[model samples]
Target: MKRRHFLQLTGATLAAVSLVQTARAAQPPATDAKAFRAMRKYANLSFGRIAYVDRGTGDAALFLHGAPLNSFQWRGAIDLLSPYRRCIAPDFMGLGYSEVPEHQALDARAQLEMLVALLDSLGIRAVDIVASDSGGAVAQLFVAHYPKRVRTLLLTNCDVEPNSPPPGIKPILDMARAGTLADMTAEWLTDRAKARATFGAAVFVNPAQLTDEIIDYYVQPLVSSPLRRSQYERYHLALTPNPLAGIESRLAHSTVPVRIVWGGSDTLFPQTDAAYLDRIFPRSQGVHVIPEAKLFFQEEYPSVIAAEARRVWGMR
Candidate 1:
């Protein structure tokens, strides 16, 4: 071939390659980090600096996560629901990305206090709460104490009066007290295989969904330092039935609309508790059961969570 022809062919090939590269670059990153990093915000509460995600606009939907996990648990649900309303997921003090000291006690009440302060900082008067596990306990306290501040309550597989620190997790508490839980947690954080075999397999219906990046997101804070591990232990040791007991009577009379989302396969918290809750909160719309799920069903079925939230909150 002639030199001129060869040069023309090379230039055309280079241009095509450049275009392909540009298109690939323009495609959005597939991870939750790519979608949510920009929404990160912080509220410097009395307890510590609380990291939270504030996304979209309109009325607020406050998301509270359970122990050993943080606002990261709600990312999938938030991503699904943010377009219709403001979504706020906070990192409980001593967990997630929050800037907190190790020794502070993070019982249900302290968590509740931090939550209220964070809400005040954001100037949010009321919210529709979607919570799970220990977060469900915290949500119950929030709605019961500050009835006016809550428009709706959504709870799934949470601690209730007489069942706080459900039986299935008792061994974990023993481990935490024995000083082995943190080390084991640290091991899981570094090893995806261990994380899947232990915590991930037990909690998630589909353990394969727990990606390495997401595992890092959940475990990084807990294993960040010795202080963090101590903080986690302290938080667990502080758990009791007292907080739920204090608010039990009040929940029955609460005028706020409530909904119970239960994981049917959850051996830890029985389905009977769902009925118990429905009876306590006469205002409850009724329980919605997800049969294939265990503990963290919200992660797997975020669309259902979003749908029920919209229906209850009167958001289309």
Candidate 2:
């Protein structure tokens, strides 16, 4: 498998990128109200209709988001990186606007399979992967099973083997099992105030950063219907089992460069997990810990993600 070592951007490749920009000026805005609603697309993969956002033109950069959240989670990151890579953000089968069959298995392995099919459908063979939260767990699975498919990986606060389903997530997990997670999320959709007070505050550092549009984008689809609500519960419940189990050896031997950008304030995934990743990945690019940040810092800190992405892609 050929790796993306564009240590220096060639003039020929630059010309092609420039040509595309000239052909189609002003790509659709990704970080705005109409995102995931107006500009979103759907791919008819094996699982079902997979929702996604495709922007720019070049090599693909796949962005996988956390649970309860969809492709909207990466709007900020995509906004910055799209100019360089054809940024692709897909909502997993059970979450977001993806219309999945009720019978479809909503688990780690299933999610990985869906991604493979989705990429194949998109005619993209390889990608630079940027993943967050539970999406990070699925990203690990993708790297373990399909190592060559990934040129580079950028992971934010998420699950690692040592604490696969982090202790802090127990409450959410419990809510899922009791079938109350969906209702709670529905309430969040109905009462944005309650959501602003709890859900936003739990995931983000400053609750105010999670605007009404964000809350609506993240929560509405999850509980828009009975099927969506049930799938929402199942999605969280699937994480109860350690998804990253036994992949340590495969990851340790992986030649794919991985960068761990963790948040200091997220108790769900401690710094020790970051150290674990650094020790495990043979080509680990080192860790970047942002103080006072929380789990969804990827949304809050796009510049950090963009800079690191450029570094990993050898664009800088």
Q: Which candidate is the best by lDDT?
A: 2
Alpha carbon deviation, residue 104, candidate 1 (Å):
2.3
Per-structure clash totals for the candidates: 0, 0
**Per-residue lDDT over 1-316 for candidate 2, one digit per residue giving the tens place of the 0 to 100 score:** 1132221123323433443333223334347857447879999877999999999889999999997789988887788888999999999877999999888899988999999999999899999999999999999999999999999998888899889888887898899889898888888766888887987788787788777888888888898888988898998888867988898999988999887777888878888887788778878766766778889877777767777787678786
Candidate 1 Cα misplacement greater than 4 A, ranges: 1-31
Error of 2 at 183 (Å): 0.6
Give each model a TM-score.
0.87, 0.89
Cand. 1 TM to true fold: 0.87
**Candidate 1: residue pairs that collide:** none
**Model 1: per-residue Cα lDDT over 1-316, one tens digit each:** 3444334335533433443334323322232864565677888777888899998798899999987888878876787678877999998876778888656668888889889989899899999999998888889999878889998988888888878878788888898889887888878766898888778788888898888888887888887888888777777777754568767789979998876777888878888777678777857766666676788877766766766676567653
Clashes of 1: 0
| Model 2 error, position 75 (Å) | 0.7
